[model samples]
Target chain A: MSEQYVEEGDRRREIIEAALRVFSERGFGGATIKEIAREAGIRSPALIYWYFKDKRALFQEVLGAKVPVVRAVADLARVMDLPPEEALTKLGRAYFAFERMDARVLRLVIGEAIRRPEVAEAFVRAGPGRVLEFLKRYLERQIELGRLRPHDVRSGARMFVGMLIPQLAGKLFFPAMVEDGLTDEEHLRNAVETFLRGLAPES
Target chain B: MSEQYVEEGDRRREIIEAALRVFSERGFGGATIKEIAREAGIRSPALIYWYFKDKRALFQEVLGAKVPVVRAVADLARVMDLPPEEALTKLGRAYFAFERMDARVLRLVIGEAIRRPEVAEAFVRAGPGRVLEFLKRYLERQIELGRLRPHDVRSGARMFVGMLIPQLAGKLFFPAMVEDGLTDEEHLRNAVETFLRGLAPES
Candidate 1:
C-alpha cells in the first residue's frame, strides 16, 4: 500500500512536468488535459482528474513550480555582500535573464489578464510582488548599513527594477528595436551605472 | 466636380475618426469593416477600401494620425523655461496621462505585434521611439546648459520614462498591484522626485 502511494506521488509529478511542456508548446488555451495525459504516458483520464481538479488548476501549479521568482531571491542573497553597484548589476542581469527566459509564461499570464482581472492580480502577487518585496528588503539593508544612499526604499526599489524592464520587454515584444551593436550586457551595465549614479548620496 | 472632391476629403477624415473610436473599443482582432462603416456613418464598404486597403492599414493610419509622440515633444517645449524640479515633475505627469489615455490604442498595436514584426517596429518608432529621442535631445540640451548632470542621454531618457510606466500600466492590467494612498498624482510625484534626485548634479 505504501509502495502504491509512492507510485501515485511520482505519477502526479510526471503529469505536472508533461503539462508544462505541453503548455509551453501549445499555450494554455490550446492545450488540453488529454494531450497532457498522453504526453505523460498516463492512459487514464481519471488519474489525471484525480490529481488536478481541472486544467486551470494544473496550469497554476505549473507556473508556481516551474517559473522561478524564488530563484531571483536566492541569487540576490548570494551577492548581498558585494558593494551596492556590483550587487545590483548582478541582480539586474539575473532579473533580466529570468524574465527573458520566462517570457512565454509571462505572456500567458498577460493574455489571461486581458480576459479577467483576478488572474492578473494573482500573477502580480505571486510573481512581481515577490521580486519587488525582495529588492525592497535588500535596499533597506543597504540603507541601514550606510552602504547605499537613503531614499523611499519602496519607490527606490520600484525605480531600480523599472529601469531594467523597458528595454527588456521591448526586446521580447519587438525584437527589431534592439540596435545592431547593443547587447544585453551593455544595456544592463549602462542602466545599472546610471541608476547607481542617480542614487548617489548627496555630497 | 470640385465639390465632390471636397466631400471626399471630408468623408475620409470622418471615417478615420469613427474608426479610431471603434478600434479603441473592440481592438484590432474584434473590429470588423462593416462595423467601422456603420460607426463612420457610411453605408458603402468601398469607401473605406478607397482610403485603406484593409482593417490593418486603417488601424495603422489611425495609430499614426491619432497617437501623438509629437505631442510629448511639444509638451516638453512648453515646460522648458521652468526649473528642473518643476519641469520634470510636470513632464512626468503629462507623460503619465498620455500613456493612460492611449492605453487602448497601444494594446491594439501590441496584439498585432505578435503576428507581424512591421507593426511593432512602427509603434516603437511612432510611439516610444519618438518620445525617447525627444527626451535624449532635451537631456543633452540640459547637460550643455549645465542645468542637469551629464550622463548617457539615452540611458537618462530610458530611466526617466521607466520610472513612470509601472503605475500607468498597473492601473490598466493589475489595479490591485497599486497600494492604498498611492494616487496617480502621488505616484508620478514620487517617481519624479526619486528620478531627479538620482540625476542631481553634484553641488
Candidate 2:
C-alpha cells in the first residue's frame, strides 16, 4: 500500500483500539464519540465518520477483528494430524494464551456479545459457531476411530469450550483471584487435566 | 407482626420488584431514582431512600435477596442423602430452574458485577463460592467412597461449574437457540447428563 493509505489504515486501527477501551469501560450505548475521539487523540469526532460510516460501523470493525484469533486456533487444529488428546491440549493452550494476551478485547467482545443480540448473532455465526463445527467434526472423526465415545457433537463441543471459560473469565474480571494465588498456571493446568480426563474413554 | 407491618413489607417487596426491572433494563449507572420510583408507582424518589438509603443500598438488597436461590440449591445437596449422580442431577435441575425463572436478574447481576468489583465480590462470596465449596466437599466425599478418581477438589469444582455457565448464558443471550422446539427441561437434562458422563469414573 502507499504511504498515505498506510497512514489511513493506522488511524483506523487507532480509533478502533480507543473505541474498544472506551466501549469495554463504559459499554456500547454509554460510550460517546467525543470520548472515543479524545482517547484516540483526535479533535474531531467527524474523522471517525470519514473512515467508518458511524459508531455502529466502528463497533462492528472492533468486533470483527476478534474473530480471527479464535479462528486461527481452530484452523491450526484442522491441519495437524495429532492425537485427539494432543490436539485438545494444543487447542486449550492456544485459547489460554489468547485470553492472557488480549483479555481486554476478549472482555469487550464477550460483554457486548452478551448484552446485544445483534452482536451475539454476528459473533456466534462468524466465530464461535465455526469453531464448534470444526471441533464437532474432529470429535466425530475421533469417535469413528474408536478414540472417543459416541456423544452429541454439539453438547461435546459446548463442554470443551465451557472448560476454558471460567478461568479465562476469572483472569479477565477478577484479576485479584489470580493475584490472591487461586488462578495460577498450575491451577489452570490441573483444571485442564481434569477436563481432559473426563473426556477420556473407558479404559 | 401487625397488619400494618405486613402491608409495609408488601410495599417493600413491590419496590424491590420495580427496582429490579428498572436496573436490569437500564443498568446500575444508567438507571435513575425517578425511573425506579415511577416504575414502583410512587410519586417521589424519596420513598426509595426511605426504604433502602440509596441506589447502592437498594441494589445490595436486590443482590442479597437473590443469593439464596443458589445457596438453597447447594444446601439441598447436603440435606438430601442421595447417590452422587442423582444429587448432581437435582442440583442441575434446580440451577436451571433458577436461571429460567430470573434470567433478567441473572443478566443484570452478571453485567453489573463485571463493571463493579464490589458486586462481583458480593456475588462470589454469597453464591458462587458457596456452591464451589459444597461441590468440592461432595466430590471429596465421592473420592473417599471410591466412586471417583483421585482429583483435586478445586479443579473438579471448576470444571463442573464451568460446564453450566455456557448453557445458562446461552439461555439468556441466545433465546432463539432454544426456541427451535426444545423445552427448557430437555436442555437442562441434556447438559446434566453430558456433565455427569464427563465426571464419571473410568470403566
Candidate 3:
C-alpha cells in the first residue's frame, strides 16, 4: 500500500477505537461526533465525517470491529475441515475470550439494542447473526461428511450457540452465580460433548 | 388472613406494578421513589417505604415479580415425577413464555446489572440463581431414579438452561435473527432431545 493510504487506514483505526470508548461510556444515543473527535485528539471535529457518514455509521463500524469473534466467524474456512469436536472447541474458546475482552462493548451494544430498534438490528447483523450463519453452514458440511446426524442444521446452530450463552451471561450480568464449581473449560467441554453425542450418526 | 392484611398485600402488589413501569422506562440508578409513587397513584412517596424498605428493595421485588418463570421454577415439585421429556418441556415453555411476557423488565434488569454491581448480584440471586438451583436438584433426583445417566448434575442443569438462552437473547436483543424456519416449540424440542440423549443411561 502507498504511504498515504496506510496513514488513512491508521487514522480510521484510531477513530474507531476512540468511538468505542465514547460509546462504551455513553450509549449510542448519547455519543456525539464532537466528543469522539476530542477523544481521538482530532483538531477538526468535522474530520470524522470525512471517514464516516454519520454517528450511526461510526457506531456500526465500532460494533463490527470491537467483536473479535466476527473476524473468527469470517475465517471459518481454516477450521472447516477439522472434526466437529476440535473445530467447535476452538470456536468456543475464541467466543468466551471475546466475551471476556470486550465485555464493556458487549454490554453497551446489548443495552442500546434494547432501547433502539435500529441498533438492535445492526448488532444482530454484525455479531450473533453472522456467528449463527457460520455455524449453520459448518453443521451442514459436517452432516454432508457423515460426522453429524441429519437434522435441522439451523436449529442445531442455534442450539450450539445457546449452549454457550449462559456462561457469558453469568460472567457478565451475574457474577455471583458463576462460581458453581466448574471452570469455563470444563463447562465448555461438557457443552461440546453433549452436542456431539446428541448429534452422532447411527452406527 | 384478616381483611386489613389482605388490603395491605394488594396495595403492595400495586406499588410493585407501578415500580416495574418506572424502572422499565428509567433504569435502576435513574428511577426514583417519588416518580414511582406518582406512577403508583400513592399520595405520599414515603408510603412506598411502608411496603418495602427502600428503592433497592422495591427494585428487587420488581425484578422478582416481573419474571413469571421464577414462579414456575419454584413450582417444579408439580412436575418432578414426570419423565425428563415431559418435565423439561414444561420448564422450557414457561421459560420462553416469561421472556415474551416480560422482555421489557428483562432488558431493564440486564441493562441495570451492567451499570450497578448491587443490582447484578440481586438479580442473579433472585432470578437465574434460584432457577439453576431448582434445576440442579431436579436433575439430581432424576439421576437417583435411574432415569438419567449418572454425571455432574450441576453441569447438566447449566447445560439445560444454556440450551434455552439463545432464543431468549434473540427475541429480546435481536428480533431479526430468530425466524430461522423452526418455531420456538421446535427449537425447545431439539434442545430437550439433545440434552436427554446426551445424558441417557447405559442400556
Task: Go through the candidates in order and give each one's DockQ.
Answer: 0.48, 0.32, 0.66
Q: How should the candidates be ordered by lDDT, best one leading?
A: 3, 1, 2
DockQ of 2: 0.32
lDDT of 1 by residue, A61-150 (tens): 676666654455645567566678877776777666654436766665565554456666666665666667777788888888777678
Off by over 4 Å in 1: A1-16, A25-38, A43-70, A74-82, A98-101, B1-13, B29-38, B43-70, B74-84, B98-101
Could you tell me the lDDT of residue A6 within candidate 3?
Answer: 50
Docking class of 2: acceptable
Where does model 3 sit among the CAPRI classes? medium
- Measured with C-alpha atoms, the lDDT of residue A25 in candidate 3 is 84
Ranking by TM-score: 3, 1, 2
Error of 1 at A94 (Å): 1.7
Candidate 3, B1-203: lDDT as tens digits? 53345577788998998988888788777889999999988778988898899887787677567776677776777877889999899888878886443787777777788767888887787788888888889999999999998887767888888887777777666777886756779889998998898888877
Q: Per-residue CA lDDT of candidate 3, range A79-192, in tens?
A: 888899998988888777764437887787787887688888877777888889999999999999999999888678888888777776777667777778667798889889
Residue pairs clashing in model 1 are A198-B198
Lowest-sum lDDT 10-residue window in model 1 chain A: A174-183
Q: In model 3, what is the error at residue A24, expressed in angstroms?
A: 2.5
